[model samples]
Target: MKPLHRLLALALAVSMPGGVALAADLRVMTSGGFTAAYQRLGPQFAAASDNTLSTVLGPSMGKAPQAIPNRLQRGEPADVVIMVGYALDELIRQGKVAADSRVELADSRIGLVVRAGEPKPDISTTAALKKTLLAARSVAYSDSASGVYVERQLFEKLGIQAQLAPRGTMIERIPVASVVAKGDYQVGLQQVAELLPVPGVTFAGKLPEDVQSVTRFAAGIPTGAQHPAEARQLLDYLASPQVQGTVQATGLDSVPR
Candidate 1:
């Protein structure tokens, strides 16, 4: 080989891996409920892998269970999606997400919140929770999954559905704890994981054993993802023990079994 050609070949070989590494970015579309935990993990993942992550956070609007699907259907770019378990399954059934890429990350249970410095109320039983709800002058909750469940089923069962319907407030996007903290409501209800991050609010406790609602969260690579391997690595990092303490601090329990 000519001397110039030999030097060019050596340079190309040296640069190829760097080019491949620079070609990808992990695009993640995740629900707002998981935002706190992801905020901690996303940076660590990026630093360790030399890959960039772009995260879009919000509840699935309109007809989609996750924002990623709605974006994907419209030709948006997404490498991975993190959302409630059942929602991710729906995406898999539609062939938008890789079935084998699905991973259960954590389970978030619903809980009650009060303003910081206020006395926490007893919610250790279904009957006690019902009494507490009815007695509260005002109550706030999300417009998301836990809130919907409370509105559609739990409140009715407690026999205060009518009263709550007239006065209960449903918050969207913003954490319910913020509402309670501002004195807009006497109590707030949302995922335990969500409640922990808001300033000026205190976690009361999870719902009683018999009536608790736990939402399981999972992640999956989109079927046509440009960075499938990186997406898997991010998911693995989320489920690893190194991230477990951060997950717990955010009030989410690692998925059991």
Candidate 2:
């Protein structure tokens, strides 16, 4: 019975629970805009919960509209997802995420940036902002949600669509701040949170009052998440008051609700 005893020992070893080898790994899929916040919080979450977080940073292109849905349809594994509130709601309706697991984290507003030491231009009103855009040699913006909104709706509303069409450029994958830093464009426009992180660029300010658009960011657990409890804990930590200050310092507003 020596061989049978050996087989039982192997089974015991493999089936053992509460071991480091068997610890849960929470896989998270997030947009590039949240990179800085996650970099700070991921390690804290791991240390507090004794669970591992594996993050996948996706491009900002259609962050809410297309990229997320495409990734879910492609069968990407994600225990948790962090993105715009409207997008998360859509995913909930599509049955990709747990409807009850949603939690609002922060709010981001669109802003402009110019190379450090450059003279800051006025964009305090719709008319003034339009003039600034027209006067710029070449403007750079993202290919993501904010950029799309600006290009499709705001510019047309401002009556300068024709002027920017020929010379303006939309950057994808890379941050708009980088484009401004390289002198490829006279000004960069993106979420305030995104523009603040890149070096060599100084924030001008958020868009004017009437035209300003704020995107609410949130986190949700996938419906079939293997570590739902751990995911909830991480979400709680992110939305806590302690984390909210960091969120605000990054140019995002604290979620009011």
Candidate 3:
């Protein structure tokens, strides 16, 4: 369906009564990459179903105190978790989450940002992206998956690891664009969904296809969840094609069903 049609469909759905049998309170722990869409769609589900949501925002990985895994390891109360697919799988492997509860929600690609009002740099091709990096006074990336790829693999892939080493930074527990917007860095790279929401930054465009890091955002019900059935209802809502236009609007591409 077209964007408009999808939005209208979702609107109609939200306006109608929901199918869940009873109202429940759901605790959701979601990482930054998928937060935008979740924030938008979550309330729709809640309003339609008469459930209430308590959301906690965090990263999919890294040692940050608010990282989703750390939150889970600490036994934070949560019914469902939305994060990078691999991270959710790690939770499953650790027996913190149920493998059968997993559902793929979206794929988020890495993109560039410069402080708002600054000229957007060229990242139209691999060579152009490299050139922009080389010319940058300082480059910032997240401490999450996309940054891991850029810091540990992409520079080596571009064969500029040594040259870019001194000027690169790994931003933690916050949006890369936030730093770029504050003039702390000349350019920043992070999941496109994470980048587009921050103010005072201009999106430069995604990295070249060959170098792009696309993280799959998936959700799962954690073991010992107090509201398993309600969590499944939310998981179904998030992964549903019915609200995909809102997902794309948040810079996430819907995963193929």
Ranking 2 against 3 by TM-score, winner: 3
Model 3 clash pairs are none
Over 108-176, each residue of candidate 1 has an lDDT whose tens digit, in order, gives: 889999999888888988888998898899989887778877878778877889989877887876789
Those runs of model 2 whose alpha carbons end farther than 4 Å from true positions after fitting are 1-23, 60-66
Q: Note the residue pairs that clash in candidate 1.
A: none
Least accurate 10 contiguous residues by lDDT in model 3: 4-13
Query: Residue by residue across 1-257, what tens digits does model 2's lDDT show?
Result: 34433443343334445422234799988875666777777776665445688987664336433365667777888888988788788899989899999998888889999888888988888888888889899888887767877888778888888988886787876789998998888889988888988999878889997888888888899887888866776787788776666677787888876
- Highest TM-score, which number? 3
Backbone Cα, N, C clashes tallied per candidate: 0, 0, 0
TM-score of each predicted structure versus truth: 0.84, 0.84, 0.92
Q: Model 1, residue 215: what's the lDDT?
A: 89
Candidate 1, after superposition: displacement of residue 210 in Å?
A: 0.7
Candidate 1 local accuracy as lDDT?
0.80
RMSD of each: 7.9, 9.2, 3.9
Q: Candidate 3's residue-wise lDDT over 7-29, tens digit each?
A: 53455455445822566899999
